[model samples]
Target: MADAQATGPILQLQGVQTHIGPYHILHGVSFEVPRGGVTMLLGRNGAGKTTTLRTIMGLWRASAGTVTFDGTDITRHSTPAIAQAGIAYVPENMSVFSDLTVAENMRLAARTGAIDERRLDWVFRMFPALKTFWHQRAGVLSGGQKQMLSVARAIIEPRQLLIVDEPTKGLAPAIIQNMIHVFRELKQTEVSILLVEQNFHMAKSVGDTVAVMDDGRTVHTGAMAALAEDDTLQQKLLGLSLAAHQ
Candidate 1:
């Protein structure tokens, strides 16, 4: 990873607030994703992790605060427009076109016309199983393969920041291990990642920094190693004993 302090953040959320109907989902949530590293957004279910990502993607407009990517303000943009601004989001659903073959899904996501051979190579290399199943229908693939296809499709675009929601959800242990390796490989690339993950072990293995969210706001932000060492903080914020896991 690059020197985070020198490059500034790839994505910044400042006092962002959002609501759906009468229900408020985010309240002044703020954090930074440093360039070229995975920043895990750690929180339990219903803590507004997915909501925060959707708000950042502009699926829901923020009622207040600013979102900046690469120094450009994009809080008010639509989802497609925000995506065009170099932010790609992979929602928890894995949104892969199940009817389409793996190759077809990739081709459909190749909106830039010019193929990014390096990016394709990197993705395929990371998930060798994807290359092996290129001609198979995405829907017929295993849960892990679908997740791989989802991530590969997102990375096809020249994304500055990739926001992923619960990538390891509902996967077998073996598949989750493969997904962890894929994420670890992605951290070596230029693209930065903002990951919302429930698997603390996977997150700690791949994430550089961790941000703890609760009740629609970021409560703690620090290096993953430091957070792991703070038993009291881990138990209080994440309700897990990091020492036991370590």
Candidate 2:
């Protein structure tokens, strides 16, 4: 096995294909998420972005190809096994236990049995709303607050990689800005991030590298700065200018 910590992609997908029942979702999708930076997965709707993420998590098993994480092949691993291998996934739906209190939710995410006070404090600092409603039930929280809780859960415990989908969707401009700042700070940590986002402002703000999918396969892969600087490349790959999206 290669040493992911030394130099190389923390996560790599090669010729990956997935089938959801009878429907083929991903067709030879390939990309890489560098060891400790944010990688943006960009594509229009129904281009299989979400399916690719689900496939990585083992929620939807791939019919063919490989998903290598931290130098081990996780393509056939169960969801629990994959998670135990140090990957945390936050889906687009902002999945949170509605019946559980914020504190309880965080406690469950701790995974090692007890929540670390310092880590909890760190999470609180990143998202103060969770601290403000520590004992409050998640069901009663507003959408934006729920989104924060979802992210807080993913980061509460240490992991090698963090995967999030459309985290800024439906969030207010201020909330989105806060999320951008949080992601920026997260880059300083050891965890690598693979983010799927349609909001180019957030993507361009924090993405060190980017991969654009089209019809279930990655069509373009390059530095985010390169994509940001070239309007023609952005238009050619994404069908719109990243600058115009903001």
Candidate 3:
């Protein structure tokens, strides 16, 4: 893993606390996604993993602490403001415009006047399947294709950070493998990813660092290699024993 302090983190969430109505979800969550690494947010269901991503995107406001992106405090920014600030979010639902074609979806994601040809080429390169389905309506696409499209659209703008929520959630084994390959290819780029994933194998395959959340708080933070070795830590935090994988 890279030294977070030396290269500087593209996104940093410090002591963030969030609540929905009277239900407190996140408590003092703090972590950093360095300039060019995938930081996996790992936890069981209802551990505030998705909420944390929402908070970063300003979909859910944090009652305390700050969300810093590219060294700027964007804790209180709006969703549009956060997006304009170079942070992209792909929610659990893979929010693609169902009525639109794949190309049209990409066009809508282009904030700038002219579309980014370089980013378009890169996205197509990463997922050639997308290029083949460019004219097809997003609603008819497969689960994996929609996920790819969602991620591709998010990266169309020059984003410094990407918050992906449960990307592998409901994907088939083969689709999950392909998605993992896509994430690996994305990691080779300059974008920093904050991946909220319950798929431990997928997370382990692509993540540079992993943070385990339990009961609305971060309970463990370490390199992927270290976490892969500690069966006790895996079971305690994620309720899954990685002993079989070992």
- Number of colliding residue pairs in each model: 0, 0, 0
Error of 2 at 145 (Å): 0.8
The parts of candidate 2 lying over 4 Å away from their true place are: 1-5
> How would you encode candidate 3's per-residue C-alpha lDDT over 70-150 as one tens digit per residue?
877999999999988888899999999999999999998887546778777878887788899999999999988899899
Q: lDDT of each structure?
A: 0.86, 0.93, 0.86
lDDT of 1 by residue, 129-149 (tens): 788989998989888889989
In candidate 1, stretches whose alpha carbon ends up further than 4 angstroms from where it belongs are 1-6, 243-246
* Candidate 2, 146-214: lDDT as tens digits: 999999999998999999999999999999999999999999999999999988999999999999999
After superposing candidate 3, which stretches have Cα over 4 Å from the reference?
Answer: 1-6, 243-246
Tell me the RMSD of model 2 versus the true structure. 1.1
**Total clashes for model 3:** 0
Cα TM-score of candidate 3: 0.93
- Assess every candidate by TM-score: 0.93, 0.97, 0.93
True-structure RMSD, every candidate: 2.7, 1.1, 2.8
Model 2 error, position 220 (Å): 0.4
Worst 10 residues of 2 by lDDT: 1-10
Give the per-residue Cα lDDT of candidate 2 at 127.
95
